[model samples]
Target: MTPRADPLTVEVVELIGTVVARYYEEYEHAAAEHSLTGAQARVLRLLAHEPMPMRRIAASLKCEPSNVTGIVDRLESRGLVERRPDPADRRVKLAAPTEAGRATAQRLRDSLDFAREPLGELSVAERALLKELLQRMLGMTPE
Candidate 1:
């Protein structure tokens, strides 16, 4: 004997999956338009805030270290990112976004207007409710 999910639960899960799939499609398109792969764009965006070590980047990206190395290699070749020695630990390498990388990341983010197009149709209150629900689903406190 096995427990079965409620019909409403399944429907909600499917809807969420559909929304995420569409979002990724739009996001990847934006990245491609900027002459960057999704992974490279993701790395540049992550480094926009602060420098991070290669291992930490791998953890954040949820990928193998080797994969991150190749991504970084490509980004570095484009002069989008640069690797520097961690000040505290000479053996560790940190990746920092260059000025060009920041600009490219910003452009990609600005170009991804998929959610904005649909959300624009909602009332302010509806948008607020949607944001609250999304935050709750992500296990984040409403700000």
Candidate 2:
């Protein structure tokens, strides 16, 4: 026999699930608006900060390396991404975002208004409290 969660806990969990589902739905819509699949848009967004090897990218995306290869292939064909030799190791290849890729990723991010609109309504203190609580729940240092 297992102990049951309290009412507040159950409600919080359900709200979290709802938030995640809504976020993904909005992300998919934004991706399609840019004429890019969710996977391609995600990869491009991941590369915005720095180039990453295919294996690392696959791990980050939680997908197979071959799938990342296909996504990269499509993005490369569109002149959005380019593959380059990893400077640290010649044998490794890194995927980097081109100017267009960066622009597209920025646009995609900008178009995600689902959370932004609601979050914008939060006061600074309330927003900080929410962030801190969420970080704590995820076992991260509340910074």
Candidate 3:
């Protein structure tokens, strides 16, 4: 026998799911304006931040390495990113964004301005409070 999730828990989960879905949808729409798919844009953004192993990217994307292979291939074909053999371990490969990729990511981020309006509604104090609460919920320490 297993206990059922409480109604409140279920509702919260559904709400979170809805919010995430909406967020992604909005992101996709914004990315489309720049002639980029959501996944491609995401890859560029990730690479801009740090070089990562393909396996690590696959794990983070919750997909198989083979699936990530296509994404990498497409980006590489566009000259947006490149894979290089890790100096420490030749067997490992790391993915990094090219200058073009970084520029594109920056442009996309600047164009989206996703939270500009919504965030504008909050005062500085209110924004700080919201940030603190969200960080706690996400199990992150506030800086």
lDDT, candidate 3, 1-143, per-residue tens: 22236787677778778877877887898778867889878877788898888888888878888877888899899888999988889899998888988888898888765466677899999999979987988899986
Ranking by lDDT: 2, 1, 3
Give the TM-scores of the predictions, in the order they appear: 0.87, 0.93, 0.82
Which lDDT tens digits does candidate 1 get at residues 1-143?
22236787778889989999999898888899999888888899899989999888899999999999999999999999999999999899999999998888888888989998999999999999999999998999976
Q: In lDDT terms, how accurate is model 3?
A: 0.83
> What Cα-based lDDT does every candidate model obtain?
0.90, 0.95, 0.83
Root mean square deviation (Cα) for candidate 2: 1.8
Off by over 4 Å in 2: 1-4
After superposition on all CA atoms, what RMSD does each candidate show versus the true structure?
2.4, 1.8, 3.3
Question: Comparing 1 and 3 by TM-score, which wins?
Answer: 1
Clashes of 2: 0
Q: Per-residue lDDT for 61-106 in model 2, tens only?
A: 9999999999999999999999999999989999999999999999
TM-score leaderboard ranking: 2, 1, 3
Supply the TM-score for candidate 1: 0.87
